[model samples]
Target chain A: MGGGKEARRGDVLLSGEGLVRRYDDATVVDVDSIEVRTGEVLAVLGPNGAGKSTLLRLLAALEAPEDGRLLYRGRAVGRDDPELRRTVAAVLQRPYLWRGTVAGNVEFALKARRLSASERRERVRQALQMVDIVDLADVPVDTLSGGEAQRVALARALAVEPEILFLDEPTADLDVSVRRRLLGDLERIVRHAAPAIVLVTHDPGEAFALADRVVVMEGGRIVQAGTPAEIFESPATEFVASFTGAEFMLNGTVSKVDEGTMTVRLESGASLEAAGSAEPGARVRVGYRPEDVVVSLPQSSSTSARNRFDTTVAHLHPRGGLVRLRLEADSLSLEAVITRHAMEELGLQVGTSVVAQVKATALHVFPA
Target chain B: MDVLVDAARQALALLLSGDPYLWGIIARSLQVSGSAVALGLLVGIPIGTWLGLTRFPGRGIAVALVNTGLALPPVVVGLFVYLLLSRQGPFGELGWLYTTSAMIAAQVVLAAPYVAAITLAAVQAVPPELRLQARALGAGRWQALLLHLREARLSLMAAVAAGFGAVISEVGAVMMVGGNVHGETRVITTAIVLETRRGQFATAMALGLILLAIAFAANAFITRVQQAAPRRRRPLTS
Candidate 1:
């Protein structure tokens, strides 16, 4: 199932081709293509206005796409098809629990599928236990706190034993501690339940922690989709790189290519060599981690370092025990982090000359 | 003051003596209005839910029409019902005019719009997410609709109280449509009007008291149903 691109066409459980959803004149969701197959946790990762929730709604069959076919199990299904709804359940960011007891909320799914009385009770008990909220089963929904309510909502969806589970920012409203615990529970659920999950969240950390495959979206369109390692280590777009906190980005043109390495001349007039297949004359975005660039004084020049730039410490911003130095050259702007001891020992300050060393392999060069 | 005191005493005497005529009128009032409210509920709830939840081009207009109907004058409703059931009118051939059925019909006309509009508001007040949540749980459309109505049970029951209140206390519409016939269409409100016109102030006042008592009782009952923990400690079915 984790064969990446090959899994995409093998057993596509749900797919949307050329899907478009508009609210008035504003297009809220525009997916040229997307698919969720069985046994994979797909994370739609984006910011608040990135239409992640809207895309989840579209895939859950809760909404009708204005310009696409929502194929379920390889057959075209109507947006109002009751059968389709039964196969999938969604827990929205701020889910509305029916005005009832916790058990009743979970029982709702059982009721909808017309399960027998004893069976409903059994399923409700199992679902509540699974979410670790069985003790709150008989408690009124209004009495439950946010975390408890979210757990009950999860139980409600899980009670259905759906083939697909759509959790739209499930822990977006939880406290930090609660969110962490719920994330652990969610991962465990994915492992034990074995249902295809589409978790929608703007938190990249959450996506990387939970999802098997990550789809990065921006401004209502999916910009990148890959494994979490691929996304975090070598983001395909500048937005993905910035979102992942590997924040350094520079516009550069490839000047030379020899073997597997390419020389890129930045707009700032600094040259960097990176191992990439990009052809010469290609405009590309180069990104690297702040910690990847080793900051030291000019006297301690490391000869073995291949990509070393002599730059000045423009400013220092202290963060706890680490000092963030904003570096500047004639045309390059970069930020690097070093310990306070290093700052004290090197006597680095504004306008101080320093050599920034970065390994060529750490530079992520992608065609812009 | 002495005259008023005497009328009150006389009213108590008329009440204690169990006047068959007065009791009969009270019974007729209950039957007609109860039947009307029932009929209204049977037709209004589904329509109101549809009107409240659906998003079509003319939905706002339909909702506006229902809201406007909430303020419809009883006399106007009576006049229309009378015309519709009049011999020369289109539905006049049913021969229900000037009968108890016509009184019930008029009361239903007064009550239905009130019920529908209030139910619409009640159902709308239930958060939109409730339905979405219900559907996400695999509920069919009808089940989801019922769940919304259930969540708004208090308000929907209040709609019933409003509907019954409007129909039970109305005189103008029933008078025009049923002609206030004795031993037939002489409900409490119509009888009160008739007795008052004939200068029987005590009897009219007595009927008014009974009518108020009935309304208070009905509302009390509806309130109990509304306020009582609508969801039982255990689900009634499962």
Candidate 2:
């Protein structure tokens, strides 16, 4: 889907309307409305105890909602409908294999579909091959490694060719390289098969890398849902921004209104420009990604293309290939990320006066 | 001390000799306990599986009732069965009183709850994710249960073993219901009691030793099955 309107036309593959689930006095899931498209991957991102798993359980029909309805393909299905039952498959966070050969585990799903023996065998073979575990087909399911087992689980779900796939933290426990590889394979599978995917995870990078659209959840409610680029460029809420790694939030007051753009002056006395229109003298919050802020040596030439400010480095911490610098300018603090090589070349140190350049378009402004 | 040693030696001799009387006692014990365990498996496994997987208003009450039955005294059950099968009691016209069938009925009652409670624990021990995964994979409710039972085969077998162990060693119910007939209903436990009361300490000790061996064998076989069951492994693919 190229536009927002087209994105909503993916045919309401799954929807939760006013869904609520309660355990004793605690409400675990309280989504007002959320929908998954027919052939798109929607990543549900949240921290621990944020009800991500609870929402997945609700959608999978493993747990019933206390209130509201779950519509699948425009029909209400509440864990008892055989038609809806046949259309969905879920791969949970901790994958479990039945007592049998790996081939047998994959065949179990196909058999449920009433496929003939020959057809079942072929489907099982294809599923195994898809997960790159064909060689382990005859091996006992209990003998495979963690990553291998997860692949087998996926293969089992894929064998049935489900219309929807719910994956709960599929690669949470996997190592970095293995997780990356599995994620890559999953991306290919979803793209080619075009099954609606609801992937729940706490990793922002994973969400950004795989999701066609990202839904940020907190306290059992969906705070925001949009394309990855849309969320990155402009988060609808502060929670969404922070969850997506928008770390520095500057509280400022609107100083001047220029057409659709607003110039806001922060407590640090540094004025920043943003593209959102707001009434003059209104309170606002401005945020920018750390990498979007560029650091240069003092006395650098100001260019028309950049919003430059003179600042002193408050702190420098090296992380991986980049060094994150906390800079102070007129009592306002901003975080900037620069390469270690650049830091060494600039001989940047704490208390050193420097020029921080931020692009106006990169700055996201929201009503306080 | 010498008399005790002599009785022990005589008991061992009788066992090694394969006395027909002793074999008869063993056969009767097997007949009663085997049938009871089979019936227990039939009724207990499904109930246990259901109780483990589904939630209902009285589920906790049912579980507690089963656990309470675990400590139910054999003598108390025997008394209840005796009263039920006695003349002037319900179904007394069927003449089940003092028969092997009556004894088996008592044993079944005594054993089924043990099986059910153990099986419930076993089935509950299985991760809930496994059931969810099965359902998500498009398996119907029955299919999910069957798969879960297969995954938990070893534990279920242990439940059956526990039930057999409980019934086989029980004396009061078998004695009260079967009347401990000389050639028919004389199970090991009942025969041991009878022989001891009749001053046949040697025969009593022999049957007691055989009973212990059978219990040990049953437990060993169950343990072997549990060990043979597959270890948890990650799926081959996700």
Candidate 3:
């Protein structure tokens, strides 16, 4: 991952400025500027109704923005511009396959361009082989499973060898295993081809897995845009933090500020030190992931975590091999995740008192 | 009972013997209805596709008008065509009255609406995203539209079947404009009516059976064509 973003990113292929889309009385997408660079995967991550798909549509020129201009290689382009259309392709959430055999579906895009029959056949062969579905070429689309159908959709898009690809939750409806396989295949294919890709998804894990740059969107606007590590480590807002797996939130008021460090007094009378400066008496929120909170026996002071809380376990939620413990202290509650092996060793159950520790760097502080 | 038995026996004899008069009426019926449906397809597919796939200010009214045509009674259409082809009407100078051309014109009016309405329904039935997908894949406007039509092709065949069904079986329109002239404009439906009125029950029964067989054969052919692609799946050797 060293210098991955700068090393892999190529020249800007497409850009949008002052894009806005409104449906009737409500604006569904509003973005000031966005760029898509060659050989880079850009993920638009957000919750449902966040207009991420709408933004993709705008950038892809599938739907013209009500107010904005799209530049493809420094030239303004319209949704109906054949030049723009020839270089771009999109695979939607649902496959929307034509009523035909697999090979026919793949050949359709090629046929649209009025390509010769030989070239179409060759490209169709290559695309199906790329998706590893060449054997099913002659099978009708209706008999394909969902995963297979999605592969055919991908193959159809790939057949034209587009310069840009837009994927709108390509694996949203798939099962976990199927999703993983498709994601793996997609990663390999996209990396090999190195086309500028705009992937719209709600799953942060997917963004992390594929994106070099992540743009977190909310409320029809982009809230933050940065490298995936930058987004995961220093989210700019509570929504971003929580959406990226920082579920534990505590509201507090700053009590002391010194040397880029501040101590915040929690509502439960617990004071915690975090690495950020704020005016004393300023209200703020502290957020952290469950895995960042360490649990230990009361007498064990072997860890160097800056803040420690003695709390009793209120509930235990087991997720696969990991267990999530809801710990309650005096008038305060927080969650911590520990391994099943650790829980067994500690003999921790509801009402068992233990110490929870978090390092100052683990806490993300934002104005409430 | 005896009259019915005699008519059925004589009807089979007339059919097997291929009576030239009866065969001529059958041939005329096919010619008029076939030409009308072909004309209907020429006129209806584009209008229906345009209405179905695009949005414009009067689209609703246009659609409503097409829907209204779907329910238009054959006799009403016949009377409308009758007045137009009559000697004193607007198109009277054409002198097409009591001729096969007039009958074809009347059936065209009847069949075009069926083609249009069904084509509209078929186009609308395709998933809207399909056209968008085609465009996203670099299909030109008309190419996307052709793709949409191809996707709705099976249903379009039904449109053709419906149009043919409406005109071929219809007696009113053809009879009014055709005038059922002997050796000239008489078609299956009209000839059956004439024979029945003249107490030529055997000939009428024979014509009736031929009409049913033609309708069945046409629909069956369309159904077969519609089902051919969907049911075919080559077995994968790998």
For each candidate in turn, the TM-score is 0.87, 0.91, 0.93
Top candidate when judged by lDDT against the true structure: 3
Given candidate 3, what's the lDDT at residue A9? 51
Report, for every candidate in turn, its global Cα lDDT versus the true structure. Answer: 0.85, 0.85, 0.89
Query: What is the DockQ score of candidate 2, to 2 decimals?
Result: 0.55
Question: TM-score (chain A) of candidate 2?
Answer: 0.90
Q: By DockQ thresholds, what CAPRI class is model 3?
A: acceptable
Summarize candidate 1's per-residue lDDT along A1-368 as a digit string, tens digits: 33343224237778888889999999999999998887788999998999999999899888888998788776788668766887888888786888879998899878878899999999999999999998988898876777788899999998898878999999987777888888899878875553588999999988998888999999999999999988987788878888887755568899999998889998878898887778789999888878778988888887788788888999999998999888887777778989999999999989899988888888888787
Off by over 4 Å in 2: A1-9, A298-301, A341-353, B221-238
Question: Which pairs of residues collide in model 3?
Answer: none
Give the CAPRI rating of model 1. acceptable
lDDT of 2 by residue, A102-216 (tens): 9999999888789999999899988888888999989886778778878988898888887888889989888778898998998777665446889999998888888899998
Q: In model 3, where do residues sit more than 4 Å from their true spots?
A: A1-9, A298-300, A341-348, B86-95, B216-238
Model 3's DockQ score: 0.46
Interface RMSD of 2: 4.6
Highest DockQ scorer:
2
- Predicted model 3 interface RMSD: 4.5
